[model samples]
Target: METYDALLASITPGSGETRTIFDPATGGVVGEAPVHTVADLETAVTAAVAAQPAWAALGHDARSAALFKAADAVERSAEELAQLLSREQGKPLNGPNARFEVGACAAWLRAAAGTPLDPEVIVDDGETYAELHYRPIGVVGAIGPWNWPMMITIWQIAPALWMGNAAVVKPSEYTPLGVLALVKVINEELPEGLLSVVSGGREVGARLAEHPAVGKLMFTGSTTTGKAIIRSSADTVKRLTLELGGNDAGIVLPDADPKTIAEGLFWGAFINTGQTCAALKRLYVHDDIYDAVCEELTTVANNMPMGNGLDENNVLGPLQNKAQYDIVANLVDAAKASGARVLLGGNPDPGQPGYFYPTTLIADIDNNNPLVAEEQFGPALPIIRYSTIDQAIEYANALDVGLGASVWSPNLTAAREVAARIEAGTVWINKHGAVDPRVPFGGAKQSGYGLEFGVEGLKHLGVPQVING
Candidate 1:
């Protein structure tokens, strides 16, 4: 499993073609994975189709046992896996421990297990009895992104496995090794082919979406790609869960403290180098406190150190790839051309290599501007001003995407009121992008549908049928 060729033994590649995976921080070739052809995908799906029923038959308790063991394995290998992920993904390793992601995955498995499948019976009018039962939907096609490969994969696949379904997971081509390592350890406790990882490129992803044997498709990535998956899955009518792109807006109300909002603004918009699906991409500030907030945020952004993920003092890391770096650089440069001023960092350092870009802040940008409305998916934040709270909410909801939002106000009641008005799936008052294992998470509107990371997440794998006896 150390080499890319060793990892591809299970599925034979077509044409002997492969894609090179690079370290985002250093632009070094870490490994190579086969660019799986349509045939390779079919082979993997065939194996999943053959293996799913037996694995499902093992029941929930057996699944739980395997997951508990996987948790222990994750803890033992936390250091190595974290190092590998940091190398591939270009995220700060010290600030956010990779073990937290592993622990959360284990928690999801344990919570989803032992969920009763039996029908709940209730008699009405002393004659009629109605019952509700949950059943697994068969094989799931889970495609995870490279931003947080190990975390996002577990978020999508762990619940599916716990609900008695086999998953054929496709990790993003750029960061496949960490997940391969994770699956190897988990498969030790589960049956072979129960939890499989197919390492390849876009063709493999398309095959998974369109495959007839796949009962469901779960995807987390860009909006355009999510649309493609939805259209393809529609032909087979496969069950689908899409957690797509987000232009999450953070509103700083007039009553909000500039100092406090600055902290939330930094982490919400810049975490994972702003590769997060629900990261704050737009900022709406009340006209009364706008200048002060921007000044404070600029100071904080300037002080933040950027470097390779391995550096302990580096709070920010490079963009995961060249395309992302170009996207951020171009968008910021566009803003400057259109009269938007850079209050803080809006340029990359000349000395740094790879896709390293500094934390960027763009002010005086219109809501109609592309930078404010589109999903930038990079470490760039565009600030807009509004005089009224209603106006702020309108501006936030104006975007095509609505995954998450944050409303900051010193007055708790006012903040909750503002948070309630936001159109996104999850809204945090005096906080941003904060989530727990116990609550459901996802997006709404064009941002995408389907829930993840809670009891509702297990329900995503469920099929309901009426038994009229």
Candidate 2:
């Protein structure tokens, strides 16, 4: 296993044009990432196209074995990866943050290797027989987001590679070093030219989306960028899987014990310091227990330490970048101006050097307030009060983006009933954003389409074919 410094040295560009990455928590120089251009993207695509057939010809068993080996590679370098991710992405090393994200990469790679996907016999009558099979899509282009860069890159590429497609990845400009290091580790067990990372700018990403050689595009980022990819891929008609922006809602039913569910609610909304795409952003608490719920959540939020990610005691860290920090700050300011009550922290220390926003909990906010309505992707949550279940459901479904949601209640049947009424890709009972690799997850409405994880995720990376005899 490579040490953290060695791993960083491996991905850091020695000479060419590069961008210096800084730690979001301390503003210290992390490393320099190569600034690949459109020409670099083309070269990567060409290499991927040339290498795909041999990879596809390896058959499922051989490919799965390679993926298993790659998973092992990830495990070997897990600590180094976690440290780098913690520094670059500003998620803590402990808790469900950097280390957890690194572990998830290994788990997902193993899941892609182990999940069975055999051809199915559709019909076997005496007169005729038919079979359905999935074929590789040649080359896949993966565009990952900064929030969970290492894990989400694994999410996009693992299944794609397992299904016999070579991939070219474009890491988010904000967090390129982590993704580059991750790909470097995985490539240790992979065939040369089969998978590559081109850490480039907008032009490279745009080129990858429109490249005729790329048969499919898997993207996880903002809704606006997803739409742009859709437009760019129109000419090539590439199969696209997009997991976009989400302002997920969590409803705390009147029957729920505020104290029992408070910790769950805190992590649901504040995991990865609330930078998750599916983290609960807006919460609706039944009026009967609204104040109690708010009090409990604030208590839970107050105890969690927030500081530099490298500190083991600090489970939460600064926002990953200045732009995201501004967005969260502005939304919270707007909420305060609209007469929203700050239950915990609403004031940030201007003297702080890094992009650290306080763990803020806003109560007594209108359902349609900008902080509640918009996607404040930070450690701030707006808790809205509702008197009726029907009203809570209405507020949750009012948003166009429906990536994920949660229904918290002591009564299982009631929670399931409420979960059924919500329009989202996945709804947890009494929990939020707890994604498992065995389950299929995607988004509803504008949150973007195409499933990732499990057997369903493998099928998305392939083309269906039917044979009749």
**TM-score for all models, in order of appearance:** 0.93, 0.99
Candidate lDDT (C-alpha), each: 0.80, 0.95
lDDT (10s digit) by residue, model 2, range 1-469: 9999999999988788999999999899998999999999989999999999999999999999999999999999999999999999999999999999999999999999999999999999998899999999999999999999999999999999999999999999999999999999999988899999999999999999999999999999999999999999999999999999999999999999999999999999999999999999999998899999999998999999999999999999999999999999999999999999999898999999899999999999999899999999999999999988899999999999999999999899999999999999999999999999899999999999999999899999999999999
Best-matching candidate per lDDT: 2
Model 1: CA > 4 A from native: 1-17, 97-103, 114-125
Could you give me the TM-score of model 1 versus the true structure? 0.93
- What's model 1's lDDT at 184? 74
Which residue ranges in model 2 land beyond 4 Å of their true spot?
none
Per-residue error for 55 in candidate 1, Å, reads 2.0
